[model samples]
Target: MGCFEDLSDQELITAAKGGSDTCFGELVDRHTTTAYRVARSITGSHEEAEDVVQESFLRAFKNLDRFDGSKSTFKTWLLTITRNQSINIVSSFRRRALKFFSDHEEGEPELEFASNPLSQEPLDAETQLSLKRQYHTMDKALKKLPERQRTALLLRSQESLSYDEIATVMDISVSSVESLIFRARKKIIELVER
Candidate 1:
Protein backbone atom coordinates (compact mmCIF):
# COMPACT_ATOMS: atom_id res chain seq x y z
CA MET A 1 0.00 0.00 0.00
CA GLY A 2 2.92 2.34 0.63
CA CYS A 3 5.01 2.34 -2.58
CA PHE A 4 5.09 -0.17 -5.44
CA GLU A 5 8.36 1.24 -6.77
CA ASP A 6 10.27 0.04 -3.72
CA LEU A 7 8.96 -3.54 -3.90
CA SER A 8 10.82 -6.29 -5.74
CA ASP A 9 9.30 -8.37 -8.55
CA GLN A 10 8.42 -11.15 -6.14
CA GLU A 11 6.47 -8.73 -3.97
CA LEU A 12 4.66 -7.33 -6.94
CA ILE A 13 3.70 -10.74 -8.17
CA THR A 14 2.29 -11.54 -4.78
CA ALA A 15 0.38 -8.27 -4.65
CA ALA A 16 -0.97 -8.71 -8.14
CA LYS A 17 -2.22 -12.20 -7.29
CA GLY A 18 -4.06 -10.68 -4.38
CA GLY A 19 -5.99 -8.32 -6.71
CA SER A 20 -3.75 -5.30 -7.12
CA ASP A 21 -3.96 -4.16 -10.74
CA THR A 22 -1.45 -1.41 -9.93
CA CYS A 23 1.20 -3.97 -9.04
CA PHE A 24 0.57 -5.87 -12.26
CA GLY A 25 0.84 -2.62 -14.19
CA GLU A 26 4.19 -1.95 -12.54
CA LEU A 27 5.36 -5.41 -13.57
CA VAL A 28 4.33 -4.69 -17.15
CA ASP A 29 6.15 -1.33 -17.11
CA ARG A 30 9.33 -2.88 -15.73
CA HIS A 31 9.54 -5.63 -18.35
CA THR A 32 7.93 -4.23 -21.52
CA THR A 33 11.10 -2.87 -23.17
CA THR A 34 13.20 -5.91 -22.35
CA ALA A 35 10.43 -8.22 -23.53
CA TYR A 36 10.20 -6.25 -26.78
CA ARG A 37 13.94 -6.54 -27.33
CA VAL A 38 13.87 -10.31 -26.90
CA ALA A 39 10.88 -10.64 -29.17
CA ARG A 40 12.44 -8.38 -31.80
CA SER A 41 15.66 -10.36 -31.79
CA ILE A 42 13.82 -13.52 -32.76
CA THR A 43 11.17 -11.95 -35.00
CA GLY A 44 13.26 -9.24 -36.75
CA SER A 45 10.18 -7.09 -37.27
CA HIS A 46 8.86 -4.27 -35.09
CA GLU A 47 5.21 -5.03 -35.75
CA GLU A 48 5.62 -8.75 -35.19
CA ALA A 49 7.68 -8.19 -32.05
CA GLU A 50 4.97 -5.94 -30.64
CA ASP A 51 2.40 -8.60 -31.27
CA VAL A 52 4.49 -11.27 -29.60
CA VAL A 53 5.13 -9.09 -26.55
CA GLN A 54 1.43 -8.46 -26.12
CA GLU A 55 0.57 -12.14 -26.38
CA SER A 56 3.41 -13.19 -24.09
CA PHE A 57 2.36 -10.72 -21.39
CA LEU A 58 -1.22 -11.86 -21.60
CA ARG A 59 -0.17 -15.47 -21.16
CA ALA A 60 2.06 -14.54 -18.25
CA PHE A 61 -0.72 -12.64 -16.53
CA LYS A 62 -3.17 -15.48 -16.93
CA ASN A 63 -0.68 -17.95 -15.53
CA LEU A 64 0.85 -15.72 -12.91
CA ASP A 65 -0.42 -17.98 -10.18
CA ARG A 66 1.69 -20.79 -11.54
CA PHE A 67 4.92 -18.79 -11.49
CA ASP A 68 7.05 -20.38 -8.82
CA GLY A 69 9.90 -18.16 -7.64
CA SER A 70 11.65 -21.19 -6.17
CA LYS A 71 12.40 -22.53 -9.62
CA SER A 72 13.44 -19.22 -11.27
CA THR A 73 13.24 -15.48 -10.91
CA PHE A 74 10.33 -13.64 -12.47
CA LYS A 75 12.46 -12.04 -15.18
CA THR A 76 13.98 -15.34 -16.16
CA TRP A 77 10.58 -16.99 -16.34
CA LEU A 78 9.10 -14.09 -18.28
CA LEU A 79 11.98 -13.97 -20.74
CA THR A 80 11.70 -17.70 -21.29
CA ILE A 81 8.09 -17.25 -22.24
CA THR A 82 8.97 -14.32 -24.50
CA ARG A 83 11.74 -16.27 -26.19
CA ASN A 84 9.47 -19.21 -26.87
CA GLN A 85 6.58 -17.06 -28.07
CA SER A 86 8.84 -15.15 -30.43
CA ILE A 87 10.22 -18.35 -31.91
CA ASN A 88 6.70 -19.67 -32.46
CA ILE A 89 5.69 -16.43 -34.13
CA VAL A 90 8.75 -16.54 -36.37
CA SER A 91 8.07 -20.11 -37.36
CA SER A 92 4.50 -19.23 -38.17
CA PHE A 93 5.65 -16.28 -40.23
CA ARG A 94 8.15 -18.41 -42.13
CA ARG A 95 5.46 -20.93 -43.01
CA ARG A 96 3.14 -18.22 -44.26
CA ALA A 97 5.93 -16.46 -46.16
CA LEU A 98 7.03 -19.67 -47.79
CA LYS A 99 3.48 -20.38 -48.91
CA PHE A 100 3.24 -16.90 -50.35
CA PHE A 101 6.59 -17.24 -52.10
CA SER A 102 5.56 -20.54 -53.60
CA ASP A 103 2.45 -18.93 -55.01
CA HIS A 104 4.60 -16.02 -56.36
CA GLU A 105 8.25 -16.71 -57.11
CA GLU A 106 10.67 -14.47 -55.18
CA GLY A 107 14.30 -15.52 -55.47
CA GLU A 108 16.05 -17.61 -52.81
CA PRO A 109 15.22 -17.90 -49.16
CA GLU A 110 17.10 -15.31 -47.09
CA LEU A 111 17.26 -14.32 -43.45
CA GLU A 112 15.68 -11.04 -42.52
CA PHE A 113 17.67 -8.67 -40.32
CA ALA A 114 15.85 -8.23 -37.02
CA SER A 115 17.54 -4.98 -36.11
CA ASN A 116 17.43 -1.93 -38.32
CA PRO A 117 20.55 -1.42 -40.42
CA LEU A 118 19.52 2.13 -41.34
CA SER A 119 19.35 3.15 -37.69
CA GLN A 120 23.10 3.72 -37.63
CA GLU A 121 24.56 7.17 -38.28
CA PRO A 122 25.96 7.83 -41.74
CA LEU A 123 29.38 6.60 -42.76
CA ASP A 124 31.21 6.87 -46.07
CA ALA A 125 29.31 5.02 -48.79
CA GLU A 126 32.08 2.50 -49.38
CA THR A 127 32.46 1.73 -45.67
CA GLN A 128 28.72 1.45 -45.21
CA LEU A 129 28.39 -1.02 -48.05
CA SER A 130 31.20 -3.17 -46.71
CA LEU A 131 29.73 -3.16 -43.22
CA LYS A 132 26.30 -3.99 -44.52
CA ARG A 133 27.65 -6.95 -46.44
CA GLN A 134 29.53 -8.17 -43.39
CA TYR A 135 26.39 -7.77 -41.29
CA HIS A 136 24.33 -9.79 -43.70
CA THR A 137 26.91 -12.56 -43.84
CA MET A 138 27.08 -12.80 -40.06
CA ASP A 139 23.31 -12.78 -39.80
CA LYS A 140 23.03 -15.63 -42.26
CA ALA A 141 25.54 -17.61 -40.25
CA LEU A 142 23.60 -17.04 -37.05
CA LYS A 143 20.34 -18.07 -38.66
CA LYS A 144 21.90 -21.37 -39.65
CA LEU A 145 22.72 -22.40 -36.11
CA PRO A 146 20.38 -24.70 -34.16
CA GLU A 147 17.62 -22.90 -32.28
CA ARG A 148 18.83 -23.86 -28.79
CA GLN A 149 22.35 -22.69 -29.51
CA ARG A 150 21.11 -19.39 -30.88
CA THR A 151 18.84 -18.82 -27.88
CA ALA A 152 21.66 -19.62 -25.47
CA LEU A 153 23.95 -17.16 -27.19
CA LEU A 154 21.31 -14.43 -27.26
CA LEU A 155 20.35 -14.91 -23.58
CA ARG A 156 23.99 -14.69 -22.58
CA SER A 157 25.36 -12.08 -24.99
CA GLN A 158 22.31 -9.91 -25.60
CA GLU A 159 20.34 -10.20 -22.38
CA SER A 160 23.45 -10.50 -20.21
CA LEU A 161 21.81 -13.29 -18.26
CA SER A 162 24.12 -15.35 -16.11
CA TYR A 163 24.82 -18.90 -17.21
CA ASP A 164 22.72 -20.17 -14.32
CA GLU A 165 19.86 -17.92 -15.31
CA ILE A 166 20.09 -19.11 -18.90
CA ALA A 167 20.10 -22.71 -17.75
CA THR A 168 17.03 -21.98 -15.70
CA VAL A 169 15.24 -20.23 -18.53
CA MET A 170 16.25 -22.86 -21.03
CA ASP A 171 15.36 -25.75 -18.70
CA ILE A 172 18.72 -27.33 -19.36
CA SER A 173 21.77 -28.23 -17.34
CA VAL A 174 24.51 -25.64 -16.87
CA SER A 175 26.95 -27.87 -18.71
CA SER A 176 24.52 -28.15 -21.61
CA VAL A 177 24.22 -24.37 -21.78
CA GLU A 178 28.03 -24.06 -21.86
CA SER A 179 28.29 -26.63 -24.63
CA LEU A 180 25.61 -24.95 -26.76
CA ILE A 181 27.32 -21.57 -26.50
CA PHE A 182 30.71 -23.06 -27.29
CA ARG A 183 29.44 -24.91 -30.34
CA ALA A 184 27.48 -21.88 -31.52
CA ARG A 185 30.58 -19.66 -31.35
CA LYS A 186 32.75 -22.19 -33.11
CA LYS A 187 30.27 -22.67 -35.91
CA ILE A 188 29.70 -18.94 -36.31
CA ILE A 189 33.45 -18.33 -36.56
CA GLU A 190 33.82 -21.05 -39.16
CA LEU A 191 30.92 -19.70 -41.22
CA VAL A 192 31.99 -16.05 -41.07
CA GLU A 193 35.60 -16.74 -42.08
CA ARG A 194 34.36 -18.35 -45.28
Candidate 2:
Protein backbone atom coordinates (compact mmCIF):
# COMPACT_ATOMS: atom_id res chain seq x y z
CA MET A 1 0.00 0.00 0.00
CA GLY A 2 1.11 3.55 -0.67
CA CYS A 3 -0.03 3.97 2.96
CA PHE A 4 3.63 3.62 3.87
CA GLU A 5 4.24 6.58 1.64
CA ASP A 6 1.80 8.50 3.74
CA LEU A 7 3.98 8.20 6.80
CA SER A 8 6.59 10.86 7.43
CA ASP A 9 10.21 9.79 7.14
CA GLN A 10 10.70 10.30 10.88
CA GLU A 11 7.82 7.94 11.50
CA LEU A 12 9.55 5.31 9.41
CA ILE A 13 12.80 5.88 11.22
CA THR A 14 11.18 5.45 14.63
CA ALA A 15 9.36 2.30 13.59
CA ALA A 16 12.48 0.85 12.03
CA LYS A 17 14.62 1.60 15.04
CA GLY A 18 12.01 0.21 17.42
CA GLY A 19 12.89 -3.25 16.13
CA SER A 20 10.38 -3.25 13.32
CA ASP A 21 12.14 -5.26 10.67
CA THR A 22 9.19 -4.83 8.36
CA CYS A 23 9.45 -1.08 8.57
CA PHE A 24 13.15 -1.17 7.80
CA GLY A 25 12.61 -3.55 4.94
CA GLU A 26 9.83 -1.35 3.65
CA LEU A 27 12.18 1.58 3.72
CA VAL A 28 14.79 -0.39 1.83
CA ASP A 29 12.29 -1.60 -0.72
CA ARG A 30 11.00 1.89 -1.25
CA HIS A 31 14.41 3.36 -1.78
CA THR A 32 16.80 0.71 -3.15
CA THR A 33 16.14 1.32 -6.85
CA THR A 34 16.53 5.05 -6.45
CA ALA A 35 19.64 4.50 -4.32
CA TYR A 36 21.16 2.33 -6.99
CA ARG A 37 20.43 4.98 -9.62
CA VAL A 38 22.17 7.61 -7.48
CA ALA A 39 25.14 5.32 -6.93
CA ARG A 40 25.42 4.36 -10.56
CA SER A 41 25.19 7.98 -11.66
CA ILE A 42 27.96 8.93 -9.24
CA THR A 43 30.24 5.96 -9.88
CA GLY A 44 29.37 5.26 -13.53
CA SER A 45 29.24 1.49 -12.99
CA HIS A 46 26.47 -0.98 -12.19
CA GLU A 47 28.69 -3.26 -10.11
CA GLU A 48 29.85 -0.39 -7.96
CA ALA A 49 26.21 0.61 -7.37
CA GLU A 50 25.41 -2.84 -6.05
CA ASP A 51 28.43 -2.78 -3.75
CA VAL A 52 27.71 0.74 -2.54
CA VAL A 53 24.09 -0.01 -1.62
CA GLN A 54 25.08 -3.16 0.28
CA GLU A 55 27.87 -1.40 2.12
CA SER A 56 25.72 1.67 2.88
CA PHE A 57 23.01 -0.40 4.55
CA LEU A 58 25.53 -2.36 6.55
CA ARG A 59 27.06 0.83 7.87
CA ALA A 60 23.66 2.38 8.49
CA PHE A 61 22.41 -0.57 10.52
CA LYS A 62 25.51 -0.61 12.69
CA ASN A 63 25.03 3.05 13.49
CA LEU A 64 21.26 2.92 13.97
CA ASP A 65 21.46 4.15 17.52
CA ARG A 66 23.65 7.00 16.44
CA PHE A 67 20.82 8.40 14.35
CA ASP A 68 19.10 11.42 15.80
CA GLY A 69 15.74 12.22 14.27
CA SER A 70 16.21 15.99 14.64
CA LYS A 71 18.93 16.73 12.11
CA SER A 72 18.97 15.17 8.63
CA THR A 73 16.22 12.87 7.42
CA PHE A 74 16.89 9.14 7.11
CA LYS A 75 16.84 9.15 3.31
CA THR A 76 19.42 11.92 3.11
CA TRP A 77 21.62 10.16 5.63
CA LEU A 78 21.52 6.91 3.70
CA LEU A 79 21.99 8.63 0.34
CA THR A 80 24.90 10.70 1.62
CA ILE A 81 26.66 7.59 2.81
CA THR A 82 25.99 5.79 -0.46
CA ARG A 83 27.18 8.72 -2.56
CA ASN A 84 30.34 9.21 -0.53
CA GLN A 85 31.21 5.52 -0.72
CA SER A 86 30.69 5.47 -4.49
CA ILE A 87 32.80 8.61 -5.04
CA ASN A 88 35.62 7.24 -2.88
CA ILE A 89 35.59 3.91 -4.71
CA VAL A 90 35.50 5.59 -8.15
CA SER A 91 38.23 8.09 -7.26
CA SER A 92 40.46 5.34 -5.86
CA PHE A 93 40.03 3.27 -9.01
CA ARG A 94 40.85 6.27 -11.22
CA ARG A 95 43.99 7.03 -9.18
CA ARG A 96 45.23 3.43 -9.39
CA ALA A 97 44.51 3.26 -13.11
CA LEU A 98 46.33 6.55 -13.71
CA LYS A 99 49.32 5.40 -11.65
CA PHE A 100 49.47 2.14 -13.64
CA PHE A 101 49.47 4.07 -16.90
CA SER A 102 52.06 6.51 -15.60
CA ASP A 103 54.41 3.72 -14.49
CA HIS A 104 54.05 1.94 -17.81
CA GLU A 105 54.56 5.10 -19.87
CA GLU A 106 57.56 6.51 -18.00
CA GLY A 107 59.74 6.66 -21.09
CA GLU A 108 57.10 7.56 -23.70
CA PRO A 109 56.01 11.13 -24.25
CA GLU A 110 52.31 11.96 -24.09
CA LEU A 111 50.50 12.38 -27.39
CA GLU A 112 48.19 15.28 -28.25
CA PHE A 113 45.98 15.77 -31.28
CA ALA A 114 47.23 18.87 -33.03
CA SER A 115 44.21 21.15 -33.50
CA ASN A 116 42.29 19.53 -36.35
CA PRO A 117 44.28 20.73 -39.39
CA LEU A 118 40.87 21.15 -40.97
CA SER A 119 38.06 22.59 -38.83
CA GLN A 120 35.45 20.26 -40.25
CA GLU A 121 31.80 20.48 -39.20
CA PRO A 122 31.50 18.37 -35.98
CA LEU A 123 27.71 17.85 -36.19
CA ASP A 124 27.41 15.02 -38.73
CA ALA A 125 27.74 12.28 -36.10
CA GLU A 126 24.46 13.11 -34.27
CA THR A 127 23.08 9.83 -35.52
CA GLN A 128 20.54 7.59 -33.76
CA LEU A 129 23.30 6.14 -31.56
CA SER A 130 24.59 9.61 -30.80
CA LEU A 131 21.16 10.72 -29.58
CA LYS A 132 21.16 7.94 -27.00
CA ARG A 133 24.74 8.69 -26.03
CA GLN A 134 24.11 12.35 -25.26
CA TYR A 135 22.68 12.16 -21.75
CA HIS A 136 25.27 9.70 -20.49
CA THR A 137 28.07 11.78 -21.94
CA MET A 138 26.53 14.90 -20.44
CA ASP A 139 26.43 13.25 -17.02
CA LYS A 140 30.16 12.62 -17.11
CA ALA A 141 30.68 16.21 -18.20
CA LEU A 142 28.67 17.24 -15.15
CA LYS A 143 31.29 15.50 -13.01
CA LYS A 144 33.92 17.73 -14.54
CA LEU A 145 32.17 20.57 -12.73
CA PRO A 146 33.20 21.83 -9.30
CA GLU A 147 32.25 19.56 -6.40
CA ARG A 148 29.39 21.62 -4.92
CA GLN A 149 27.66 22.12 -8.27
CA ARG A 150 27.91 18.44 -9.14
CA THR A 151 26.57 17.35 -5.76
CA ALA A 152 23.70 19.81 -5.92
CA LEU A 153 22.70 18.71 -9.39
CA LEU A 154 22.87 14.99 -8.66
CA LEU A 155 20.79 15.16 -5.51
CA ARG A 156 18.13 17.34 -7.06
CA SER A 157 17.96 15.62 -10.44
CA GLN A 158 18.64 11.98 -9.55
CA GLU A 159 17.36 11.60 -6.01
CA SER A 160 14.57 14.18 -6.42
CA LEU A 161 15.49 15.71 -3.11
CA SER A 162 14.39 19.25 -2.31
CA TYR A 163 16.95 22.02 -2.06
CA ASP A 164 16.50 22.37 1.74
CA GLU A 165 17.14 18.68 2.24
CA ILE A 166 20.15 18.88 -0.08
CA ALA A 167 21.46 21.87 1.82
CA THR A 168 21.25 19.97 5.09
CA VAL A 169 22.97 16.95 3.61
CA MET A 170 25.68 19.13 2.07
CA ASP A 171 26.06 21.30 5.19
CA ILE A 172 25.77 24.42 3.08
CA SER A 173 23.70 27.52 3.18
CA VAL A 174 20.37 27.21 1.38
CA SER A 175 21.25 30.15 -0.83
CA SER A 176 24.50 28.49 -1.77
CA VAL A 177 22.71 25.31 -2.76
CA GLU A 178 20.24 27.30 -4.80
CA SER A 179 22.98 29.17 -6.57
CA LEU A 180 25.03 26.08 -7.26
CA ILE A 181 22.03 24.22 -8.60
CA PHE A 182 21.04 27.21 -10.72
CA ARG A 183 24.48 27.36 -12.29
CA ALA A 184 24.56 23.60 -12.76
CA ARG A 185 21.19 23.61 -14.50
CA LYS A 186 22.30 26.42 -16.78
CA LYS A 187 25.40 24.50 -17.78
CA ILE A 188 23.55 21.23 -18.34
CA ILE A 189 20.81 22.91 -20.33
CA GLU A 190 23.38 24.66 -22.45
CA LEU A 191 25.03 21.36 -23.35
CA VAL A 192 22.04 19.00 -23.57
CA GLU A 193 19.63 21.28 -25.41
CA ARG A 194 22.21 22.24 -27.94
- Identify the leading candidate in terms of lDDT: 1
lDDT of 2 by residue, 112-188 (tens): 22233487534344343454475557766786676668778888986789989888777788999999999988887
Q: For candidate 2, which ten residues in a row score worst on lDDT?
A: 105-114
Per-model TM against the reference:
0.73, 0.70
For model 2, what is the C-alpha lDDT against the true structure? 0.73
Candidate 2 clashing pairs, residues 3+ apart or interchain:
none
Top-TM-score candidate index: 1
lDDT of 1 by residue, 1-194 (tens): 54368899999999988878888889999999778877766766667778888998899999999999998988998998998898887778675787677775334333233344577654666775777798778668877888788888878886789999999878899999999999999999998888
Q: CA shift at 170, candidate 2, in angstroms?
A: 1.8
TM-score of candidate 1 to 2 decimals: 0.73
TM-score of 2: 0.70
Looking at candidate 2, what is the lDDT of residue 41? 69
